[model samples]
Every structure is written in C-alpha cells, then in structure tokens.
Target: MLQETSRDPVGVLVVEDDAVTRKALCLAIESDPGLKLLDAFDSVKPALDFLESSSPDVLMTDLGLPDGSGIDIIHACARRHPATDIMVVTMSSDEANVLACIEAGASGYVLKDAGKLDIARAVLDLRAGGAPMSPAIARMVLAKVRDNKKPAVPQSSPASDTTSLTRREAAILDLIAQGESYGEVAKMLSVSVGTVQTHIKNIYGKLSVHSRGEAVYEAHRRGLLQLGRPPGKRS
Candidate 1:
C-alpha cells in the first residue's frame, strides 16, 4: 500500500523523462509528510491524459521531455486544473527558460540541483500561494528586471491616444501572456471564466491584436508587462 500521512497531503504529479531523476523526485515527495505523489510520467502525453481524469493539487515537471516541452504540460494543466499549482523542476536555469516557465503560469521554479529539502519546501510554498524560486533562479529573475529597458515615447506623443489599461486589465493580460488559459485566469482572479474572456476581448480591441501571442508582444512593446513580478501581483 502507498504510504499515507495524517495531514492533508497536497497531491502532486511528477513529469520527467530521466528514469533515475524521476524516481529520486518521487522518493523525495513521498518522504515529505505534506505531499502525496499521485503519479509520475516520463512523457507529456500520458501525463496529460491522466490529468484529464484525475486532479492533483500540484504539478512538478521538467522542461525538456522526450515527447514535448514542459510548457505544453503547464498549458494543459492550466486548462484542466486551474487551481493546481505548477512548479518547474529542471536542469536548465537559462533566463529564457525561467521567463518562459513563469509566463506559462508556473507558481514555482526550481533547478534540478536544488536539494530534496529545497524541492519539498518549494512545493509547500507553492501550496501556500507564494511563488517559490531557487536562489540562483531568483537572482536571474532580478537581473532580467534590472536589465529591462523603458519604452520610448515621442516628444509629441498625445496623452489622449496613449493606451491606458486598468490595473485589473493589465493583470489579466499578464497572465494571458504567461500562457494561462481563461479558466485559470478566472480562478486566480476570483471571476467567472466568461468575465476573463470578455476582458481578453476588450484587451484585443484596445491593442488591435487578435491572438494571445500578439497581445503579449504588444504589452511588452508598450512596457505594460514586466518580468520578476508574478502575474496579478499589481492588483
């Protein structure tokens, strides 16, 4: 029988292609009394299939899978299980990877080099609604923020024509850029998914953009979206 603990265990699904690493992660999660390992998968396909029928409270996934990228897993989970927290547990600490994962609605980012205890602590923090990042990852995020360039405005720029977004609208757009589905944004904002959809439509109309990618790109161009801060942090 699977070892069960008395405390309310946060069910977790582990997704990593490496057999040894996957087993080790599963062991670490099992050792923690606050986490319960619901399932482990070596590829995205099966993991997504399992998520459709069953739900886990947290998802710990690797960035590079043999079949698909971890971003795919994050996108799927955000749609299927909006309330499930996501953590990226991978070897790549590249700034691009970090930004991509966070944009994809991940609540935590931990490198594989993080010790078992660190991973456990990250999971716990994620469950508690805090964005967890390994020390190096956190530093990388800060560096990106520091290096960001301010958008330039022409000297004759008209204030009336300048695109202005409300705090909530900007927050919703940030999440949308980060790859969160409508359902996930709704849960995070405590609003109906229909409300999220309506906001997204209005955002597109204001920006003259048609798709999510376009909206994110436009927001970045306008300096409306910034790195380091989690989506919805402003409101």
Candidate 2:
C-alpha cells in the first residue's frame, strides 16, 4: 500500500504486546507512503535491545508490557536517541501514566481504539513536530493544565489507613514506577517474587490505590517518588 516517493519514509518502531494491535499498527505504518516501520516488538527487552543498535525516527509503544512498563523504553529512547520522537499507544488513558509518559518525552498520546488511519497520521504528525493526542486525552490534559494553574490544594489522606509508608515500601514503589517487574525487583533486592508482591500489596494499601499506575500517580502527587529521571535513577 506504500506510495512511491522520492524521499525516504519516516522510520517507525512499534512496541505493543497485543498481537492483533501490533499487526494493525505495523500495517498502518506500512500503508502510509510517508512512513516505514523499522521494527515491532511485544515486550520490553527485545525493544530495548533493538534500540541499543538502531534509532528509529518515531517510537510508538504501549504503557504496559510483559517485562515492564513502556515508560522505561521511553526513557531510554529519550536519553539515548534524543532525536527520536516518542508516542504512546495504549489502552490506559489514566492521568498518571499519561502524565508520566509526557514527562518521559512522549509527544504523542493516542488510545488503541483510534483507528489505523488515525494511528498512521498521528505518527506523521509526531514526526512533523506536532503533539497528537486522542480527544479524551487531550481534554484531560487540558483540564490538568488548568488545574495546575490554580492554588495548590492541601494533600490529605485518611489517618486510619496505613498512609505512612516505610522506607522499603517507598523504595519498592519507586522501583515499580521505574517499570520493574516484581521478579526483576526481587532479583535486584535479593528477595523472592512473593515477597515483592507482598510489598507491592502493602504499598497499594498504604497509598490507597489498587493498581501500579494509580500507586505511581499517588506517590508522585504526594512527593514520595521522583519520575522521569534517568532509567536507573528513577527509583
């Protein structure tokens, strides 16, 4: 479906775990005359490996991956390939991950439900130095921006809940925010995966959030975590 052109097409690298979505994204890139997909991967490791050798023009990745969060990939690309433009194509539209990706250097944010044509155009727009976002994401970002302009609201948490986190729990939360899987964190800390899970569960309770994304958002909001640092420095 590629159209003939004298100029080289923009190179695109896709990282999506869902098979169907990955294929569709690849096809979308291929279908565009101005875009060429350099590679596609379903997990974080291979993508990181590929990035070590090749720098694509655009990186479209999901936030959730089998090995870790896509934010790690974004951080690597942003640091290693500063010229590359980062984009997020994920089912997660939550503010925490979205803002994290933005802070991590993703200039485009689109939902998976955005059709193939839109995906291709988004890549093009991204490469053209435009920030593209799904409508909902765009609106949410605008609202967040507006809210940021307002006076700071005093942060409060229920005293009954385990709101106070231990140093280890905060460390674990930071690692999770850095996209480390439980097993990876366990290996890094020399603990069992079960123990890591228990720590994460306790972190959730203490943060009053159920999921990793929420935990990260809450922790960041409360100044318990510093995100968007160099990969290892994130946690």
- Which model scores highest in TM-score? 1
Q: Pairing residues by index, what is the TM-score of model 2?
A: 0.61
TM-scores for candidates 1 onward, in order: 0.63, 0.61
Task: Give the per-residue lDDT digits (tens) of candidate 1, residues 1-235.
Answer: 1122126888999999999989988988899988899999999999989988988888999989999899898888866776677888899998888887766667678887766546677787666535677889878765665566565442444432587777788988877655465666778888876677678778767766534544665677677775456655766
Give the alpha-carbon lDDT of every model: 0.75, 0.75
Tens digit of per-residue lDDT, candidate 2, span 1-235: 1212227889999999999989988999999988998999999999999999999999999989999999999988877786687888999998999888877768778887755447787787666435677889888876775575434343665533335677667777767655565555676776776676688778766765534545665666666664344334433
RMSD of each: 8.8, 15.1
Off by over 4 Å in 1: 1-7, 114-117, 149-235
